[model samples]
Target: MRTIVITGGTDGMGAALARHFLRAGDRIVVIGRSRAKFDALLATVTSDDRSAAARAEFLAADLSLVADSRRVVEHLQAKHAWIDALVLAASFIRQHRHITAEGREASWVLFFVSKYLFVTGLAAPLCAAERPVIVNTAVPGTRADAIDFDDLEMSEGFTFARSNAQQRRANELLGILAVTDNPDLAYVTWGPTRLVRSSFAGEVGKSMKIAAAVLGTLLGQRPDVAVRPIIGIVDAPTPGRAAYRGSKELALTVGDHDDEDAARLATAVEDQLR
Candidate 1:
């Protein structure tokens, strides 16, 4: 059975994807902050499908912390000899800037650093698999110009919108750069074609949450529907680096394929972790 690892698998799209794969008889490993939520997710397995429950595993972690992210990497590497798919879906949305105990912006660590750690840290096991793939659910092609290399932490002028946009750009660059290191693994950055109704709506401020709920009601797909293309890619990944919005493939702009900028961002992340 294929081994699938999903962060943020306790709820929303990640959870839906976990259930889908479990029903398909694949082994699923989910990382999230809440043991209770993890239990709730596993409890959804039908009584007749005892094997689905048996195949599910959960790792409790706060991806917002650097140490916690690293610890997760260590734990996974030790336990799983080979991983077929790694889905980076854990996310946190804050209306105001919040610094972690490690003295970095929360989104920078959670959205970008944690992803970097997981992909790079799990390189061996992922590559060990016959057809390894990573599906990062982020806005890939929408924000090519949002990043500022000088101040990645957004200390100067921090706003929730800008921070979120910057993180999306960082993730795009990550997908590009990661493949350069391990050409055998396929790294796909996927953006939803329409808004998705998920727990992400509740994480923002009241005003934005209301807006999200309205927008989601008007133009959103349920997590199960939205996860189809992601599963398709995981089953048969595009070689090297690729980006998608729903099922449609997006051509990378010249800016998106900049090795120098991608390398620079990688170095900055390494420095931040140090």
Candidate 2:
């Protein structure tokens, strides 16, 4: 059976993916912050087939903290000798700037840093597997200009839109750099063609939450529908780096895959983590 590790597997597309893999007889390890949600996911999946419960595991960590992210990496490394797929799906849309106890912006840490740690930390186990793949479920093909190298954390002039855009670009760079660093593994930036209805309403302001609810009702796809293309890619991933919106491949711009910028961002992240 294929081994899949998913961050944010308790909700939305992640949860949908977990259920799909479990039913398909794959071993699933879900990382989430809430034990209650993990238990709920386990209960829901097990209700269908008690045997599937043996293939599922959950690790709790506040991914917004660097230390927590590191601890999770260590734990997974200790437990899994070979990981077939690593899905980076954990994120939150913050209407206001929130700093972690580590003095880093919460969005940057949760969205980018934690993912970076996972990809790099689990490299050995991932490469050990046959047809290892890393899927980053984030907005791709975003303008690279959105990222401000000087203030990656958005400590100055922070806005929800700008922060979101910056994190998206950062993830794009991550896909580029990871493939360059690990040519044997596939790194894909997977973007939803349509918004997927999720629990993000709880993280935003009252006005944005109402707006999101209206938009989600009108334009969002159910988590199960949104995850179909992602599972397709995970099953038969192309080597190296690529980006897709649903099943359609996107062309990358010069800035989107800049080696210099990718290296610089990696260095900056290393410094921040240190």
Candidate 3:
């Protein structure tokens, strides 16, 4: 059985994927902020299958704090000999800018920076695995222009859509640069164009909740159907290529300058945080 570590596994697609993998007999180690919620999911996922529950593990962590990311990676590194796949599925979309103790916006820290930290810190186990894959659940709202090199933190003016698109772009580009560093591992960034009505969809306000539900009903697919691409991504082999997922094959594109951009992003964020 493949050993997979998933972030944001307590909710949204991560939780659905966790249950799916567990039922498929894979060892699932999930990271979230709440053990109580995890316990509830564990019960539902396991159901009558006690063995499946036993195969699953959960680590509670507030992923918004980059300071805690290292500890998370260290713990995972100590526990597992090799991580078959790392699913960077944890994300947040907030209407307002909330700066953390690290002085970076919470959206940037959670969606982009901490994701990079997880992969960089856990590079060892990832490389040691028979088949190493980094599956990033990235949204395709904005292109490369989303990142403001001058205001990476969006300190001047911020909108929820603007910040979310920026982080999503960062993650997609990060997959591009990450493959160069870890040639043995495959980096896949999933970009589902239609909304999936995830847990994060409704957390903002009532209007957003109604919008999400209506949009989901009209345009979005169920979690089972939407996550099929992700499952395929983990199962397939596409090393050193940053693959984008969508309905049409023509939409899948890669970048030639992602290495430089990823380096700039990495250095800027690391330096800023320090």
Off by over 4 Å in 1: 201-203
The C-alpha TM-scores of every prediction are: 0.95, 0.96, 0.91
Q: After superposition, how far is residue 77 of candidate 3 from its true place, in Å?
A: 1.6
Query: Candidate 1: minimum summed lDDT over ten consecutive residues — where?
Result: 252-261
Q: Work out candidate 3's RMSD over C-alphas.
A: 2.2
Once superposed on the true structure, which residue ranges of model 3 sit more than 4 Å away at CA?
Answer: 201-205, 246-256
Rank all candidate structures by their TM-score, best first, as comma-separated numbers.
2, 1, 3
Cα error, residue 234 of model 2, in Å, equals: 0.7
Q: For candidate 3, write residues 1-56 as lDDT tens digits.
A: 78999998888788878888888889999998878878887898667688888789
Residues 1-274 of candidate 1: C-alpha lDDT, one tens digit per residue: 8999999998889999998888888999999998898887787785658667779999999899999989989999999999999999997788878888988888888888899999889999998888999999976765567888889999899987898888888888887777776788898888888888988822577888888889988888999999999999998986698889999998864574478778888888887777
101-141: candidate 2 lDDT, tens digit per residue = 88889988888889989988999889888999999987787
Q: Give the TM-score of candidate 1.
A: 0.95
The candidate that wins on TM-score is: 2
Q: How high is the CA lDDT of each candidate model? A: 0.86, 0.87, 0.78
Q: Least accurate stretch of 10 residues (summed lDDT) in model 2?
A: 251-260
Sorted on lDDT, highest at the top, how do the candidates line up?
A: 2, 1, 3
